[model samples]
Target: MQQKLIYILFIFASVISYGQVNLFMESDKAEYNGKDIVNLTIILELNGVDLEPQTRFQLPDLSKFTIIGSGSVTNTLIDPATNTLVTQKVSRIALEPKKKGKIKIGSVLVTVNNKIYKTEPFDVNIKDVVEKRSLATNISSEMYLNMEIEDREVYQDQPTVAVLRVYSKNMDNFRKVKDVRLPRQDNINVHPISFTKSEIDPSGAGNMASQIVAVFMVFPNEAGYVDVPSVSASVSSYSNKNKIVSNRVKLNVKKLPEGSPEYFKNAVGNFSVNVYNASKDKIEVEKPINVIIKVSGEGNLPDMYLPKIVSSPDYEVFSPKITSKVAPGTTGMKGEIFANYVVIPKKAGPISIQTEPFAFFDPASREYVDLGQKTLALNAFSHDQILESRTTVEKVNEYTNTLLETVNTPVLKTTTFKVKEKSKFHWNILLTNIAILIGLFIVYLLFKTWQKKRALVRETTSPKPLGSVAETEREIRETLKTDINDYFSYLENLKDNGDYEKFFDTLEEMDLEVRKQYLQSSSDDFRIRLESDKGSSVAEEYRNLSQRIQMEKYSPLKSAEGMEELLKAVVNLYSRISK
Candidate 1:
């Protein structure tokens, strides 16, 4: 009787389910660092002919997560594998873990009339936020550090980007990260660069809301497979400190192919070479004119430069005055570079501005790209005309100099001389004079001693102009309140402006002043307080920001960035420094 009743119940359940009913839970990422949003999608397929189009469902225990966003969509598609047109009602919920640990989303239940359907529980590993460097401690498995090179395979001297990022899943929010270390290899050159905090996943970690914390322009000096050591960093959060260590990365660098051009620059990147003049219509004779040679393109841009224009008797060419506006980007270092040559026509006639053909090894094409300006004649004065003007000037100068010499000639003369006789001195007068001399010297010495003592007193009593951390903080806050900080005010306009000297100089000064007043004195105090208040990232902000600032300020060729990234960082950090 029991078996018959169970069979009847199963038949009734299948009949009510219609074609084929199903419910499943899925996540976009297989592994998640605690900081990222764990996306959960609950999909329901209704395929039976007898079932209702829609039904109500209940979510499992999601009390441990903060739902930042949630939505549902309905769509019908033909399932090729199953060979059926199925209707799916998909519900997505973006969740941020409230706590760190190995956790799970419990089973979801759907009820219709008197029937109940359940979906299996989903397992989620939200890595623990350990507060120490020892990874052997009894804790859940964690993955936080990641490093990536834009191109794993490259030629010798070719440029690529390497990125290091630390994302802590154990913290409610990030406090700060610092001391990011990338192993140094003798065969590689690592140049640090600054970009805005971005969301592009250079490390292939995941497509979650994130920032590119550290970026480096990498160049390999040796040819062959090189093993790059793993990257590491110190990460701090509200309640925990994590030592993030990434997996090691490798780079394959190949030697340059044979048969390179004789004039080929030892650059391995794409580039375009152009040699042209400022004025197209006229080229004045025996005068200086600007001839432009612009070399601009992506690929090893930082190491690329224009070779000297070959010298010719027809014209004299000075070394190029290069102006670069290159900054790091998503791909690598990319921007326009200009080299201007001042050419003076020595012998005027039909002449051409001659320059050595610029060639660079184009890694993309696996060949050398060579280009020089087309042969264009300039209208100039002939050698005879140039010599005619010079001859006239010399003649005029010679005639004037001779006339002046003749007018100012010295007259011949002679004079006689006589010697003086010796005289005797008295002993009493000598003694009195000696006494006066001694008295005067003593007085002068006393005066000098007094002056030195007074100067020392003044220096010792003088007060420094440096402000305290509190004072500096208040001043920055006031500046922010008034919107008077010029660094942030006209940063956009200054980006395209040619001169960034003043900007970087002021930035260096600001960094120095802050260090002298705020960081050196009150760093630990404020760092502890801020971290206690869940704001350590602000403290760490200065660490990363100062580094980038120093790099930009001291780079061989600084970018006209106006340093918007730095300005935003400063503003963001200080704005939250209060309460």
Candidate 2:
């Protein structure tokens, strides 16, 4: 009896381990900084049974953490002991905590073969970034970010250069740099300039140790004291890190003084002007004369204007054809402006074409200077005198009407012709009528056959009508309802197919369709209208939705929940507008 009981116990133990599944969960790190990323991996392993079609896996609640990235993979292996196939499914997620605290990850559930399995819950401690920094030696002093402006004082609409430099004492020890955020200000347009890695030098040769990381050409739209905010960059070393920041810079923009001459063309720099006539010194009346005026030097050529040439009673001056070639430079803008004038002389006399003086403010001298006046002299001849001198005389007619009345003439005889009588009706005419009737009958039969074929084709291939404009508008309105039932249907389908790009594209299309139905224009036009009407709240929401969609489509880190919330907000706004 004792031997039989021992044998039965061993058999029971073997049967229990034969067809079982295992679930395991682990984290890459037990503790993490609030800003650093942590990876969580959940794996499910099964033996002696394949995963069922109805099997499902669900991740734990991650509301307190930001999921930067997530993905899943499956693997199959053969067990040597039982020679049975084993399958493992792995799900990995990268996350960053929202705040410094003890975060709890709940149980992960897996359902397979009509059974449910779960992993135990765990806690992760997230320490504050400041605390992490205190534990290591601070090397922030060795690295710094500095911003310098070419000129602190600039005129409105003038281009100013802003250079951002990164300085480090030991380049060899620097590991990496990231999140170099630049400053942005209202009414200032920033243009980026390209640079390369070779431009950076750590050796103090001619003060070249600093790296010119970013160069921006900033243009101020309005005149006043403009304050440029500080910029920050994060740099990492072997055991320490630094958040380098530069000081703020203030710009003094002095408005152009009043009492500027009418000829002052809004030019604010050092420049020269010249005027000349391209026509002959003497010309006949009603002839056209050409005058060329050129303004060239360092200044705003695009905005500058040429002084109008006064039109007198003796001359008719048309509008000047203007052209310019301006380019940006380190010192300032440099180019030339050419104005071609066409003038007509109406009367014959000495004509004087005069131009008003051109003036511009010289920033270096801090004063306005006037370019001297220009005049062109020309002589004109009378049109009638020239025509009469070039005229040729014609000989007068010698014969009179009395001579023609004295002439005579003669007469002749006439002839007559007769017509033959008709014979009933010609056989050829009867035969022609019969042929025409037969041709008509044949054409009628062909027409009937073509009609039947066309009807059959139309029945088989014709497209359904899209209804009316009002019906389309109603459909669009229904689709963009605040409840977002239809929108979520599309979202779920796209997510299941792993097509986030198409998901964002569909949202954009919906936005456009909404704008077309209600505003009768495109999204761009709707934005303009909202801005013009001072609808700040609606405009802000629309802009935010557009920016978020664009960023999510291109960003490596994606958040499904964030996208859903944004879509809900967009749908709600559009629904309200549609109503």
Candidate 3:
């Protein structure tokens, strides 16, 4: 008996040991530049317990850094050491330093078996931007950076292609390129198109060279002198690291000439306009007809707006649904813009729909170009006539009547016939119904069984409550508030994380919460608050931040500065409202 008891105790101890949980954390790099990305990974192993989807993991306090992205994976497998089943969850978090210094990340916490496990703290060293070293004479002189643009002068909102070329000799020996930085200027938007690397012809020294080109579609917001700043890139070779900088270029943007036609729609480029009716030449009165006007060519298709369709007494025109298929390329912008108008004829007659002449300034010609006027002739028929033509029953009746009139009709005397009654019940019918009833009964039984089994499974597998709904909501609100505070506490933290999408979603939620809490608050209160000096300042900041967020959300070009301003505005608004 004593031996049996000892055996049982040993087995229990083994099971307990197999169910233990372990956590570990590490970073890919110990040191990095302030602008460089650092990868951090956390691994959690569960000896026997299965990881539930609802299991909450608390991330470390990374206020000193920004989280660019986070992802996790969980796997269950047999552990080689213990030869037992183990479940592991691995999480990867990409972070960027907020400033140059020694940033310390606190312990990460995880809850298992109602107990919290924590990982040790870690530190990352961040350094400021280092100046580039000049290349040695041994290095080839063919390696350089060059900037190119299609046109030096363009109208405002006109898209121009800018190319940054990196030329390097000895293509086979070039190692890699890193820390590519593009220029950022106010009022000018840069959109990345493509980056390509290819082998080029040999230089005079009979050495092969490689060319790397990066293309961007640039748009100037205002008519003035817009400068394209120099681009910097670091090239790594077997010998050493060399930095290459391209020359800056200035662009002259001339405003659209005055006295633009009333029908002008801010279109700039070479384009052809066409107008046609989808219903062909025939249309029914008082019914909607689609009149499509398509403009196709190479230019700023996205920014082009279609002129208003001139309304006439014969037609009732509604708003046009506009769509564009423009793609920016190294050569230039190319695509088409389509404007579909819903037009309804008022009376039956020959209706002429005329479009105003479409005009655009041609930068190549240095003058305005007209696409000329367009006219669509539509024959409108009365609704009654159209309905009559479509009435099949009336047409069939008329044809039958005409046929009967053409043929001779013979009159006949009426006759009657007797019928016999039969029994209502039949053996074949009875058997068929009996079989159907049995089949239906079986189906019903199976359905009931399935429902019971599903209920049993749900009862057994339903997740246990971590907290009540009210408690969860309160926790969420607290987390959101903390995130909002942290958003501003760290400058450019949210932007660095590339969390604009989530940041705006959180802001919208917070705004809704504030409005819900202040249900009784009136607009007059906001106005009165704005009258104060502090309120005035807050209002201005709020407007500027809101505008920037809107622009960043919709515009092709996005900036970190806009995200920082938005966070500041959100924090400020919350503070003022709380007061």
| lDDT against the true structure, each candidate | 0.63, 0.67, 0.68
Judged by whole-model lDDT over C-alpha atoms, candidate 1 comes out at 0.63
Candidate number that wins on lDDT, 1 or 3? 3
Instruction: Give RMSD (Å) of candidate 3 vs. truth.
Output: 36.1
Residues 3-54 of candidate 2 have per-residue lDDT tens digits of 9999999888756565678997889988997556678998888775555424
Candidates sorted by lDDT, best first: 3, 2, 1
By lDDT, the better pick of 1 and 2 is 2
For each candidate, give its TM-score against the true structure: 0.43, 0.33, 0.38
Which model scores highest in TM-score? 1
Report the C-alpha displacement of residue 369, candidate 3, in angstroms: 2.1
Better of 2 and 3 by lDDT: 3
Candidate 1 residue pairs in backbone clash: 18-48, 19-48, 34-169, 35-169, 175-536, 175-537, 348-381
lDDT by residue for model 3 over 1-579, one digit each (tens)? 999999999999888778778898999988898446678989998887553334567887888765545668988888787788888889987665667878888888887867788899988888873222223344436565667775766778677787776656656534354445677887776766654333454562335354545667777767866767778776655456777777666566667778777777767778888888876544899889999888888766666667557789999999899888766643346778889999999989799988878898776776778777888888899967776766666765666478557745232111111112265545664566466556766787898899999999999997967899778766655654433454344434556788666666666555555543433244445434444635565654544445445544544445566556656666767666642
Candidate 2 stretches greater than 4 Å from native: 1-148, 156-159, 164-198, 203-221, 227-250, 257-265, 280-284, 328-330, 382-579
- For model 2, name the residue pairs that clash: none
